[model samples]
Target: MKEELIAYIKSELIGDDTMEMNSEDDLLTSGLIDSLAIMRFIGHIEATHEIKVAPQDMVIENFINVDAIADYIQRTKNS
Candidate 1:
């Protein structure tokens, strides 16, 4: 699920910018995406993962990196 999610985010929302990203790529700080783009990703994750993303959960720590987003989704699923 993590791999698939990252692939979607990379191919769709991120595109060719992946040339510079590690698993810990900071999308927000690196300016890869703005707030609107972040929201779009949040929506995508919600729909893809079948999890509800709360407004309070939309933070840099959760969404800045692919690993972080994957962790967030996994944790949410367990919770």
Candidate 2:
């Protein structure tokens, strides 16, 4: 999931195939992605993972990075 998220962010969102990103990278704070990109990313996550991300779940902590997003998905699935 982390790899897929990173790949999607790079190849699809950022449109930079060569961009390097890690699971722990601060995507939001580092300016790697903006609000619009995050919305698109949430759409990607919902369509790909078959989960609904509630409005309240769209917080910074849940989307700080790839790992955080992965964790949020896992928790949502478990619940």
Candidate 3:
């Protein structure tokens, strides 16, 4: 799932080299992604995971790191 997330993020959102992603790393502060990328990521997550991301859940602090995104996915799935 981690690999899939990284691949989707890189391929769809960034369209750059996928080899640069680190599973445990944060893509936000690294400048590998930006604010706009967050929206794309959210959309991709919702579509791929078949879960809806509420508007209130769209916060930078909640989606800054890969772990956060994973947590969000878990929450959405469980809910």
Candidate 4:
């Protein structure tokens, strides 16, 4: 799931196949995703993961990096 999420983010959202990013790379601060992109990704994440992302769950800490997003998904799934 982590790998697939990263691939989707890189190929679809970021649209840069050559862009190398680590699991801990900062997507927001690094300008990999903006407000509009994050909104779109919220939809993608919810749909793809079958998880609900509440309005309050939308935060930089949750979506900062692939690892963070994956962790958020796991936590949300458990909740």
Candidate 5:
């Protein structure tokens, strides 16, 4: 899930397939991605994982980085 998120962010969101990113990287605070990008990313996650992301679930803690997003997806799925 982490790899897929990274790949999607690099290829689709940033339009730079070769860009390098780590699971622990600060995607929000580091200016790697902005608010609009985050929304699109959430849409991608919802569609790809088939899990509905409630508005309340769209928190910074769940989207700080790839690792957090992956964990969020897992938790949402298990629930």
Candidate 6:
């Protein structure tokens, strides 16, 4: 799932070499995900994972990196 999230972020969002980033890399601070792109990426995550990401869940800590995003999705799905 982490790999899939990374692939989606790379191919659909950033479309750059950031796809090769480590799991712990800071995507937002590293300029990989800008302000506007974050919304689109959330939509992508919701659609792909078939889970709702509520407005209250839009915290930077949950989306700091691919591993975090993947874990967020897994937890949300389990809930």
Top candidate on TM-score is 2
Which 10-residue window in model 6 sums to the lowest lDDT?
13-22
Q: After superposition, how far is residue 17 of candidate 2 from its true place, in Å?
A: 1.0
lDDT of each: 0.78, 0.91, 0.79, 0.88, 0.91, 0.84
Question: Model 1: residues >4 Å from true position, as ranges?
Answer: 17-20
Backbone clashes, candidate 5: 0
RMSD of 1: 1.9
Cα lDDT tens digits for candidate 1, 15-75: 8636545667777787777677677878888897899998899777888788898889999
Better model by lDDT, 1 or 5? Answer: 5
Q: Least lDDT summed over 10 consecutive residues: which range in candidate 1?
A: 14-23
Q: 4 or 5: which has the higher TM-score?
A: 5
Which candidate would rank higher by TM-score, 3 or 5? Answer: 5
Alpha-carbon TM-score of each model against the true structure:
0.82, 0.96, 0.79, 0.93, 0.95, 0.89
Worst 10 residues of 5 by lDDT: 26-35
Tens digit of per-residue lDDT, candidate 5, span 1-59 = 78889999999888999877899998988887888988898899999999999999988
Ranking by TM-score: 2, 5, 4, 6, 1, 3
In model 4, which range of ten residues has the least summed lDDT? 25-34
Global Cα RMSD, each model: 1.9, 0.7, 1.8, 0.9, 0.7, 1.5
The per-prediction tally of clashing pairs is: 0, 0, 0, 0, 0, 0
Candidate 2 local lDDT, residue 59: 92
* Residue lDDT tens for model 4, 1-79: 7888888889889899887878888888877787898888889999999999999988879988999999999999998
Q: Candidate 2 residues 1-79, lDDT tens each? A: 8888898999988999897788999988888788898899999999999999999998999999889999999999899
